[model samples]
Target: MAVEGGMKCVKFLVFFFNFIFWVCGVALIAIGIYVQVALGKALVVSGGSSAGTPVAILVLGVIIFFISFFGCCGAWKESYCMVTTFAVLLSIIFLVEIAAAIAGYVFKDKVRSVLKEGLQEAMNKYEEDPTLTEALDELQRKFKCCGANNYTDWANIKQFQANDTVPRSCCRINTTTCNVHPSPETVYEEGCQESIEAWMKKNILIVAAVALGIAFFEILGIIFACCLMRGIRSGYEVM
Candidate 1:
């Protein structure tokens, strides 16, 4: 009777964990979409290779969303075959998440150079491309930064070389004189690259926390699923 009771508890625990996984899937999807949009905007001014991460996250979330349903049905029906399949799929996802975490860590170091190159390219073509001009202006305004390295960096822009003027977005105070006659007191001294890097570090920590928390729950779900799979196979009458 005690063993039967334990199996019954495992059955419900698997169901409960599957529900949690479903909720997590929804959360991941929401986060993925938010990050994807944010990155899309930023990449307009500072193109980089990190665009794949959010898309991968979105795809993984969709997969998890569907797989959780499968797991829920397996648990409720006490089907050994279905439960085993769920366990296998969950394990694969767990491995993929770990690999993604490692890849993110590796890519973190290259962001600075990527941002510098992209910003420089955007600046050189700022006058030629209205889209780049608008995006770069928004980036500068948002970051409260002037140029790739500093305000002086804008002096090298081909279109601005004649007048030696920077964009109004580089002004610390948006006065007419600030752009026409930029000086240390009138323009932002800080570089966009530094400001953007700081912003990314701050947000990456939040992403890391969410990823770790989800990973913990995923581990729990896998363990419970395995337990339930064994119970079902052993003819413990989990139903």
Candidate 2:
């Protein structure tokens, strides 16, 4: 009877963990979509190689979402085969996530170069492409920054060269003179590259924390699924 009770407990744990997994899958999907949309905007402006990150996240989220549903079904039915399969799939996903985390850490250094190149391309094409122009202006206003490096960087752009003016987005205040005759006090002196890099670095910790938390829950779910699989295989009276 104790053995049966223990098996029942394990079964309950498996079901509970699967529920958490389902919620986590939903959260991941939402976060992935948000990141994809945000990156899409940046990619349109910069034309960088960052399209993969969000897509991978989105794919992983979908996979997890489906896997969690399978796990829940396995737990509810107390099916040894299904529970074992869920454990195996979860383990594989965990490993993939680990590899992704390592790759992200290793490639983090490339962010600066990508940002630099993209910002420069946008600035150079500012006059030729209306989309690029709007993107650059939005970037400047969002980051409270002026140009790729500084307000002086605008001097190199042909369109701005004629009027000797920066975009109105660079202004600290809404004034015509701020664009035509920008001074350190009237315009953002910081560069978009620096501002954006700083913002990313600051938010990276939050992202890491969330990832770690999710990983912990995934490990727990795998363990509970394995236990339930063993119980079901032993023909334990968990019901």
lDDT tens digits, residue span 1-239, model 1: 88889988988888888888888898889888987776564577666455565777788889989999999899888888999999999899999989878876797667677778888988899878888888888888888889898999988877777898999999888677888767889998898888888877889878788778778888998899898888877778764
Question: Which pairs, if any, clash in model 1?
Answer: none
Task: Name the runs in model 1 displaced over 4 angstroms.
Answer: none
lDDT of 1 at 1: 88
